[model samples]
Target: MADTNAQEDFSKLTADLAVLRADVAKLADTLTTLARSQGEAAADAVSSRVRQGKAKAEATASELMDEGRAAYDEARERAGKIGGDVTAVIERNPLGAVAAALGVGFLIGLLSRGR
Candidate 1:
């Protein structure tokens, strides 16, 4: 009974993660579109209004990119920490750690291919 519940919980979490990933991808596409449009307008703008808008958009895009990079850095740091912990655990139990590391590496490689 507990195992079934755990499996269901994991499935729900997996689905939620997938949805979050999709949302992030959609947001990235929207930002790209917005940046391109703003850039084109900026090229033609002679008046103050167009210049201002373009400036604002560029600033916003820069901020977003910085935030995204920071987030990625943080995630990488956390992943490194987790990997270190896993290595420690593997040292304690060599066989299990090796199997777990292989599984994790495979999944990571698969996921990294799309991006």
Candidate 2:
């Protein structure tokens, strides 16, 4: 009778172990599926962000280019007006212009010697 009881206990333990193994296998399969889904989602999110960043960079670059062009045009106009004023001044007083140029040349020479 004791030997028969031991056999029954062993059978019950084996059945329990089999059920546990099946449960573990199911859990591993579920985890694998979840990991795959999460990876795809992350990739999609990164791709979308990259596209948005590229578009924003392009727009900012275009805006900066337009601003730079406007600034250059304004500077050119100012320079032209200054040139015309200098020409008029020289025409009105040639002797004064000669004296001013000599003074500027002497100052430049002195500065160059210091350097």
Top TM-score hit: 2
Q: Give lDDT tens digits, candidate 2, residues 10-49.
A: 9999999999999999999999999999999999999999
Work out candidate 2's RMSD over C-alphas. 2.5
What's the lDDT for all of these models?
A: 0.94, 0.98
lDDT of candidate 2 vs native?
0.98
Write down the lDDT that model 1 would get.
Answer: 0.94
Q: Give the least accurate 10-residue stretch of model 2, judged by summed lDDT.
A: 106-115
1-115, model 1: which lDDT tens digit per residue? 9999999999999999999999999999999999999988887675678789899999999999999999999999999999999788888999997898899999999999975
Question: Which of the numbered candidates is closest to the native, going by highest lDDT?
Answer: 2
TM-scores of the candidates in the order shown: 0.45, 0.75
